[model samples]
Target: MVVKIIVSTDKRAVKEENGDFGFILWEILIVVFLMGIILTLATPHFGSATNQVWIRIDSANRARIEGAVQLYRIDVGVYPLSVTDLVRAPNGMSEWAGPYLDEIPINPFDNAQVYQIGTMGQVK
Candidate 1:
């Protein structure tokens, strides 16, 4: 007596039997590389937008400080000699009505608490 055996040549059947059903390492690496490129392209725009927001905030703070100084002058009849004069009354001035600001704001760029008073009551 004699026996015969046959084998199936289908690629899908072979793959299923071997359990090879996931991405290769090279494919994953390629995806990661593409994502890095996309992020590199987008990073500059995000940085510029953040800078613009900081600029606007600094301008608004300057305006508020200037306004407070103007109010101080209006009440006391002389411009403040320094930004601190807005918060504290100088000697011999009875018209001081405030701690004009809750706290002095710091410069965003330099992290300095100092301010320069320009001509015509502008804060720099």
Candidate 2:
């Protein structure tokens, strides 16, 4: 068996069949209003999620710096004078096997300073 489909090219007939063929002003306004409401509800959640992400990043960076300091102490037999020592060899250390880190990571919470190393090779 074979089936055939009939198509209409008449503008009036198509418009009448589809009943206006476009959104009215009230329909467009309703869509815009719904979108605004959705955005209003979602904005606060986005801000909180961003803050959570920053907190996690800060924790990971501190841990990484602390590990590097420990490695430096193991290799050179002394804790670094500062975080910068991880990226540069300190004076009079023949066994200084670093730039352990390519560079010290900046503290996200405080853009003005990088993470600090304490006396006992911990991140401060």
Candidate 3:
């Protein structure tokens, strides 16, 4: 089989040079840089939100523990002598509340440590 094809280009086409491929790469680089800047601006806001959520969770746990202790005191007429006292069984005249809390609440900062127990009274 034989085939023939003809191609033609005008003088104007020869004078016109296409734009550089680098222009497209530069546009892409510009878009990436803008995204980086936007993310950098938003990072602190994300951190603040995370801290606020953690603090709210800590405060909620503290309030729950305090309420439970108050109930125990109302029933027994005194705050448990110490943190350990809340976990053990209660006996006579001691006027106790068994397991003041369903379970010991953990310190948010350090889950291994139990939340601190303080004296039952108002602050002056």
Candidate 4:
């Protein structure tokens, strides 16, 4: 078996002899930069979506609380003294419709500096 090898001195003949790595590095940097921008742009959208979901969850919880209050009102003659009163007995009652709720729901918007405003005024 005989092997033949040809060697060339032409600088252009060598692959990546001039500025190849630089261009590739630049391309990679550009791609990385573009990805960072994409993520940056998408961050607020994710936050907005999360906020919307939180609002929905909070609204549902508030509605459930209101329903519990209404049930308490029906059982009693009038509205309770406060939100906590709905979960507790009115005192001097032999029997009542409830234990209306298994447990009192917590205000979901407690964090994030959020506030809840009802018809009368700020409830929580």
Candidate 5:
């Protein structure tokens, strides 16, 4: 499909001899350069935004894990021996009301690690 735009040349645009009008090369280049500069300025802010999102997700995951642990404890009369118990039934265990959690929450910052079990049952 072909669409034609008719414009007379102002300062920013150039026309062919046939008088088709749009941005000149330098004007387009300037826009692209300005966009590049804006992107460079905004890149750090975008990175921090991503970190903030991950932090929120991490905190929510930690809370979900903590809640699951609590429910597991209430049901089984003890804290889980490990986070894996949250996702899989422990061997030969009865009164195991779970797979309480779908999966163990991994540390968001370091994917290889599970959230650390810090002092006082805190997920670090």
Candidate 6:
């Protein structure tokens, strides 16, 4: 759609063929500028919201790992020495009814490393 504007006191078309082409360009520029401003103002909030979601996801993962550790201890009568023991049955342990976890969960903050377990059967 093309809009024609009359910039005269009499409100008559100044040039029908041209239709104030420069004015249209200026209008487009103004719209783009407004969009930039909006994006700039909104970007920080969006980033913070994304971080909050990651925190929640990691918190739940920590709880899940802690629960698995507790179960492992209850069955084996001691905390596993490492996180991997949750996902692999240790040798020479008859009471070890694991793979308590299907696999060690990766730390959300560090994808390459699995979550650590504390000496007292806590997930770190």
Instruction: Order the candidate numbers by lDDT, best to worst.
Output: 2, 1, 6, 5, 3, 4
Q: Candidate 4's residue-wise lDDT over 24-95, tens digit each?
A: 467789999999999999999988998898789878777776777677767776655565565577678644
Alpha carbon lDDT of each predicted model: 0.81, 0.85, 0.66, 0.65, 0.79, 0.80
Candidate 2: residue pairs that collide: none
Q: Write down the RMSD of candidate 3 (Cα, Å).
A: 7.2
Q: Which ten residues in a row have the lowest lDDT in candidate 2?
A: 4-13
Candidate 3 has which clashing residue pairs, if any?
none
Candidate 3's C-alpha runs over 4 A off are 1-23, 90-94, 121-124
Q: In candidate 2, what are the lDDT values of residues 1-124, reduced to their tens digit?
A: 9774438786656676668776568879999999999999999999999899889989999898889988988998888888888998877779999988997787777889777788887787
Of candidates 5 and 2, the better by TM-score: 2
TM-score of each: 0.77, 0.68, 0.66, 0.68, 0.65, 0.78
Against the true structure, candidate 4 has what lDDT?
Answer: 0.65
CA-only RMSD, every prediction? 4.2, 8.3, 7.2, 5.9, 8.2, 5.7
- Model 1 segments beyond 4 Å from truth? 1-17
What is the RMSD, in Å, between candidate 1 and the native fold over all Cα?
A: 4.2
By lDDT, the best candidate is 2
The number of clashing residue pairs in model 2 is: 0
Q: Which is the better candidate, 2 or 3, if ranked by TM-score?
A: 2
Total clashing pairs for each candidate: 0, 0, 0, 0, 0, 0
Candidate 1: clashing residue pairs, number: 0
Residue lDDT tens for model 3, 51-119: 888788778877877776786778778776555556665555366656766676566566786666678
